[model samples]
Target: FVDVLNTMLDDTLPLTPPEWPEWGNPIESAKDFRTILSYSPYDNVAAKDYPAILAMGGLTDPRVTYWEPAKWIARLRATMRGGGPVLLRTNMGAGHGGASGRFNRLDEVAIVYAFALWAVGMAEKAEV
Candidate 1:
């Protein structure tokens, strides 16, 4: 919790002031603290079942570091009370936009489709 909040504060503080309401002024406000805490997926993970989650990340993504999704999956696996798998697929050579070429993009799309089909028990019906 502290690490994620600190990272978010560091990243967003430069673009906006601490008093900025857009992000709930997490630096020095108690009300804002509650607001941010209320909506944080990590902090508010309920002890209930969840659908299969396929989280994708890029090694060089500037906006959302790869570790965020990695940590999210870890937490989901530890806390969630479901059989649905929580998977994380990191693109080792890609950034925020993923692989650059048309064929490479299609490959990424195929992976997503494959995951979706498997999640819905339709993998056998997939033609390719």
Candidate 2:
């Protein structure tokens, strides 16, 4: 996000001009830069306990780059003292929504559901 803002501020990125109205020009405005910096997840990493995480990154997701999740997980692992696992699954051949078919999505859902059950000590119940 910071990189994006910098590129946009320099008028290098295509979305800078059109997106200026919505996000403002961070390069020109300190307030805009601060606001963007405040909410950027990549910049706010801390050494604290977090819930079991299942972060998914898409190779083709234009909205959120795949490296974001990978970087986040690495940060979490390095900072977190101990807790439930922080997992990441990259879709090698998919985009933001993962694989295209209903069955494929269900597989993703099943993974999340099973993780949730295990997190709450309900995995056996789910099996039953």
Candidate 3:
């Protein structure tokens, strides 16, 4: 996988000590632990509504499991009454980490760029 990622970035990816271990390795620092455990995104039933975007992968992810993200997405979908876009772009091939290993996704990136432009436009028009 190093070869794959190196080809894309034209350099090696960093090997920093992960704040959260993906493979259940021993954590060496207090910064590595979340103070809260098992808090779902929509657990606060009395809170005001908020839109969300949930991106996840199904494999190689122990930190944010595929089910957790899916459940969070479902919760947002169930509670979001205003039809906000909870864009869940699943990188199933990329596993628990971010996407890589394809120039074909240039098109996907372009589409996301266009969507962002449109969103900014909508926001601007709403303010005016």
Candidate 4:
């Protein structure tokens, strides 16, 4: 979400001015820009153990470009002390909502559910 600001701050993006109310105008308000940075996940990565993360993104997602997740996962890997793998699954052919077909979305849901189970240590119990 925060990475989108890079584009939002740039005038070339579609809704830069409209986002000022919500995200603050980086160009116009230094205070607001600092505030946004204070809470931005990309900027807050710390050197400590973090929970398992499954950061997924769509290649064609207009809401968030695929690079956002890719960069986030990279930062996590670099800064984290010890944690479960930070996985990234980019849907090369999809957009923000993921694959178009009903069955394909189910498949995506199943993957997310499985990841949740694994994150909570439930997968091993269920496998028995």
Residue pairs that clash (backbone atoms under 3 angstroms), model 3: none
For 20-119, candidate 2 gives per-residue lDDT tens digits of 7787778778998888767666566678887888888778866556776888788888888778588888887678777768998888788878888887
Clashes of 1: 0
Best by lDDT: 4
**Ranking by TM-score, best first?**
4, 1, 2, 3
Q: Model-by-model lDDT, in order?
A: 0.74, 0.72, 0.43, 0.82
lDDT of 3 by residue, 1-128 (tens): 11111122221224423422442212333332222111224343222455434344445454444555565566677766664566565566555444455674564566466556555564342342
What is the C-alpha lDDT profile of model 4 across 84-107, one tens digit per residue? 578889999889899879999998
In model 2, what are the clashing residue pairs, if there are any? none
Measured over all alpha carbons after superposition, the RMSD of each candidate to the real structure, in angstroms, is 3.6, 3.6, 10.4, 2.3
| C-alpha TM-scores of all predictions | 0.78, 0.76, 0.47, 0.89
lDDT of 1 by residue, 34-79 (tens): 7777777767667789898888888987656788788878888888
Point out the higher-scoring one by lDDT: 1 or 4: 4
**Per lDDT, what order, best first?**
4, 1, 2, 3
Candidate 1, residue 6: the lDDT equals: 44
Q: Where in model 4 is the C-alpha error above 4 Å?
A: 2-5, 125-128
> What clash pairs does model 4 have?
none
